[model samples]
Target chain A: MFLALVSGNPWLESLARLAIIAVLVPVTVIILTWVERKVIGRLQMRLGPMRVGPYGTLQGVADTIKLLTKEDVRPQTADRWVFELAPFVIVVPVFMAVVAIPFTADLFIQNLTLGVFYFVAVSGLSIVGFVMAGWGSDNKYALLGGVRAAAQLISYEIPLVMAIVAVAMLSQSLNLAVIVGAQEDTPNIAFQSLAFLIFAIAGLAELYRQPFDIPVAESEVVGGPFVEYSGIRWSMFQLGEFVNLVLISILGSLIFLGGWQWPWSVFDESVPVVAQIAMMAVKTAAFILFFMWMRASLPRLRIDQMMSFCWQLLLPFALLQIIINGLVLVYDWPNEILIPLSGAGAAGAVYLTYRAARATGVRYQPGYQTVGSVL
Target chain B: MTYEEVIFYVVAVPTVVGAIGVVTARNVVHSALFLILSLLSVAGIFILLSAEFLAIVQVLIYGGAVTILVLFAMMLTRVRDMPAALDGPQRPFAALAAGAFMVVSIFSMVSTEWPGDTNKINVISIQQIGNDLFTTWAVPFEVASLVLMVALLGAIVLARGEEGE
Candidate 1:
């Protein structure tokens, strides 16, 4: 059983999974252009791109071919290795999440001992790549974007961690699979509903969509860290950005939604693998659309406003949820009772926090919000 | 060495080289990078030790976050050229002392008896950790929150305040 394998050298097993992910991430990146166009087409009430082959699918491939054939240009004043390496830096964690994601009942790439913890910890790595890309490019806009990104990622990352920890408190473990299994064991949606909600909101921010996309504030920073990049290199950065979005959406599905686990076994036999893959892909696609929808709908939050939301609104709610989760688990409370109670408590906490912030009108800067916004 | 040992040795070579580079690299940025390499190698070693949590945290925290922070500090400060060679007069003696100390420690560890054979039995499940964390290590868990609070303060001070300079 997985229990045994994970109990065994889970670290080694997870490393192997991560290695495979390194290979798969690029392929997934390539396919995502097609997926994005298809989804956006339907969203915009258009048939989407129906040229350059069947369903316009070959469009992404054609684009890739063009990028490959294009010249690799660098600014005369740029950090060469960091410039070239920035794409991989962004792409690396795109795959690291796969290690914790359980596709099938037992098909997690790497079931780390601390899946939730690792997810929280390692997800921040992408910020470095962002900063590196900015500084390495030696462009002012790139530098500003990089700083904003580092601020945004680190600031939002706190709420994200707090949200994940709420789930961990409910599950009483840091493992991602354990969290999912814990959900399955109960009416997971009911008990951890608050945590799930916080996670979704925070996850969206982490993905740099909508309100939190100020880091990539193209209007202000001029395409951010990737301003100076061109041709294939530019394409690599662009491709990686789109892929990271998909990857983050997939992560939301795996963590907040029950990854690849369907309660009703509609397709019980014969085509289990295909069914599972379909379900996962469909769920991931749904979340990806959600990302796009938010991007289209929500206006970007001011840097200070975004910081306040994460620090004031999200973090407190998440911490309180964690406490309530812990109490529920410790007291052996039933879901029917705790579900509404947790929901009320979460809402109450949010209302109180907002009221307090409004009363104070203490405008918080993103850099200052991290520690100062304790409730 | 058997095949497994050989594999471990080969895997460890990068770690060893990187660790040395972390200490001795001329450029601060290069040193920071070498330190990342060393940290990643340590994560690999943790995998070898069957410590998945430790390994992932090693990568997630050290590789991802801390390395970025270091790089951020570098960029914010804008230290392009490294310091001039600052070899001390007693450098060789210090190296010898450190080497001897490491040898003695290794010798003692080799001679000493260990309780659990990490290679033989692996029981590092989330359940097991949960059972113990809430039971015996509960206090430590609470203390970690305080540490994190302090870290928050420290990061703010270092990143923003003039004291950081």
Candidate 2:
């Protein structure tokens, strides 16, 4: 990093940086997931598979070995190359996202001129992997699920971008760490809460959890896109998902709550590295818990309902939030109008959204009639 | 070779080969996959150029989103309907167009000198672009946003397919 900065050669520096993070990011994701599972297990009042080795420290290692040694299989009718390549599609984009995410002010690896736009933009790549997996698997369920995920991601991405744009408008920055730092210094959640809400909601939708996970609704699609995957190949997809959870948690802390830095400028540079990691981990843990909580709480949406919710409700709300945020940042709005307007907007949006779905909510009771059945 | 030349070759070669594969490959999936390789190589070039933001955006948007959307469409429509992969067919004037494009691009590259010394990439933040977007280029920014709004609506409409009553 020092050499790249001093010598003015970007290529060598980027290569050097990528090599370091390629190992670093994946390692962090693995260890953190083990921790997440342990926490969740305790939350669920279960022993959480603690029999591996000493507080189940080797639980993940044991599971990994089992998955690794498992048999590899392909469906008889499946396309060979694309089936093999599906997991790579998912892995590469997540790896690429690391470039835009920064740990500290000076500790960033890939500093894009476009900043967070790079982060927002590159997110679309994973859809390819999912979609390809479904179609390549030669299974109806997989293909349908992939198509569903594709729609879900693209639709939710609008709100996600809009929410981020609101932040960029307010702070006037696109760098991930810079966004977090701005929040840490200014502490403007009072005004930015709307943006935060929009971001979180949209973000969860993007992650395809709970209400948004229709594509992988086990009962709906029978294991969805990964139905045909097996052995180490399936493990790659699983690992990618775990990495995604970590990345999204890091992002939540980044864009909404302050990332690694604490409020009030409390810490000095003299603090130890583990302490920094611990602080970041605490913030990240809160986010992961929120994610798992949402997963446990919400019921999955039907495809049309999910699609309409995003495009009609979340999209407009996100647009309005960005506009209001832009106005405040550009020419400070009177608190009189600003505060209540945001609250009313959020409440009204939610109420209308819920009401809109009320009639649609009546499900086909297992024996009830489903829509689009060719008699 | 100098460091710049080495970087140039590293980025440029893959991009060119990938571009060739994207066009020449008969299979639509192969074409799409090759397009990803092409875009990824361009992203590598952006990294080489020290435009980290641009490189990441290339990877995220072009690599992540666009590629995924294409795959989605491919999945929804056809999986095994890839007769082109088995039998290559010639496109009308494809050879001539490709030749012309390559010549023109190389000529442009050779003709244009470096954008002043061709080798300084400051690791600036998103703040700089934001400032530029809102201040010096605010008019263009608003106009561009309006254009994006139209594009967004157009995409939604196109995706939905017009079977309006």
Candidate 3:
């Protein structure tokens, strides 16, 4: 029956892609967990994992096995069905997002015409899952965390989408491969640097990482919406978060860095597919490491502070970046002019925002002793 | 069955089921979730029709944003705590009205001609849609933005209450 339903080429191809992605993402997530711990550990001067495998490289695998075997506990007050469903909702979207990401020049699952748009639109749905998890738990802490996460997601999404819009406009196409192709002369980082910054920063906030990690703030909400989840369910949420981190890095590389394209054609089209994949890996790793650095270094923002940062600071800058991009597009500015102009504009915007905030008695500085003193 | 028919049946069944569940569910959260399911299946139908852009927009807006917003509002209020509040006194009348509307709409849809070539489908690109929005529908688009701005300002005013003074 199945054989009759699907014929030779497309079916096999699609199935192969699906199987690869299904296996690849979870394995990638496991590796990311290890990388994040080790990198952050080094930054903080600690040994991350030393018992599981070589330098604790297999810690993630051990953790997974442990999670699988542990008791799956549910809160007595929790809405059982919604609680069970939320993890799937969170995880599925993260996995599906990989469908649109161009792994290399030619190696993508489905090259939809509206690839970037589809990726953004699909990725946005994870917030709904987070909210569901939070609400379903029926705990005050979980509810607060869920609501905070939802609000944060909604706020950060605007700047993230706008930044992508700048990239889409410049590329004159929404397809990820086409966007990569358009950067043959120079990557978007040279021209749409501000958009890249907004996208990356907002992307981090969207991922709910450090400095914007209020949603799952351990000191406050006790892991937020996932507080009630245990064992496999908790693992699902953890896997989703890590997958999202990788997805964001891959997206950043594809949109801003010349994806799978070595600078100055150190290796051109004649180069093997292996090299192209390696280049992509290198670029994506750079982003992942950068995110880890930020996580290790930055302090978490207060919820109010985070909200204000998005609405007041990032939103305006994102809008201004769009206007500047539109102006450049209208005048048909060459890369030579656009590059320096946008770079300076980005630097000036950052400085001006700092100056404006200072004038308004808003401190850029975090109070090192205040948090402990207040506690 | 053909591929299209198979897909249509698969999507349509859940869509109808989800729509029914939306009104019938006792829990408001469950109803909101049902609405999301209905919206998602509708997006699936849009994909079958090859309206990819419309399908994604449906998922992104209705499934992601609107459903979450509704759920958020429910969470914020005391509504979730009172499951009975989701039900109303006018259930029979509402059901009757909905049934009548659905019957009439389906009858009309089946009976009347759509007044276009049913076979020669136009799969429009996102670029064309953007161009048309800016050039052909420019006034209407700007007017929509203005309306949204007015609503936003009204929201701010209402939120401030008498404190703005």
Candidate 1 Cα outliers beyond 4 Å, as residue runs:
A1-28, A35-55, A106-122, A172-187, A263-273, A345-375, B81-122, B130-165
Between candidates 2 and 3, name the one with more favorable TM-score: 3
Taking the tens digit of each residue's C-alpha lDDT, what string does model 1 give over A309-335?
777777777777877776777788865
**TM-score of predicted structure 2:** 0.81
Best by TM-score: 3
Candidate 3 residue pairs in clash (backbone atoms < 3 Å): none
* Model 3 misplacement above 4 A: A1-7, A352-375, B92-100, B115-120, B162-165
Q: Which stretches of candidate 2 lie over 4 Å from their true place?
A: A1-47, A54-57, A104-115, A185-188, A264-275, A333-341, A353-375, B50-57, B82-165
Rank all candidate structures by their TM-score, best first, as comma-separated numbers: 3, 2, 1
Instruction: Categorize the docking of model 2.
Output: acceptable
Question: Each predicted complex: what DockQ?
Answer: 0.40, 0.44, 0.48
Q: Which structure is stronger by DockQ: 1 or 3?
A: 3
Model 3 / residue A68 / CA error / Å? 0.7
- Candidate 2: lDDT over CA atoms? 0.74
Cα displacement (angstroms), candidate 1, residue A108, comes to 4.8
For residues B67-110, write the lDDT of model 3, one tens digit per residue. 88899998898666688765689989988998999899999999
Candidate 1, residue A319: Cα displacement in angstroms equals: 0.4
Using lDDT as the yardstick, the better of models 1 and 2 is 2
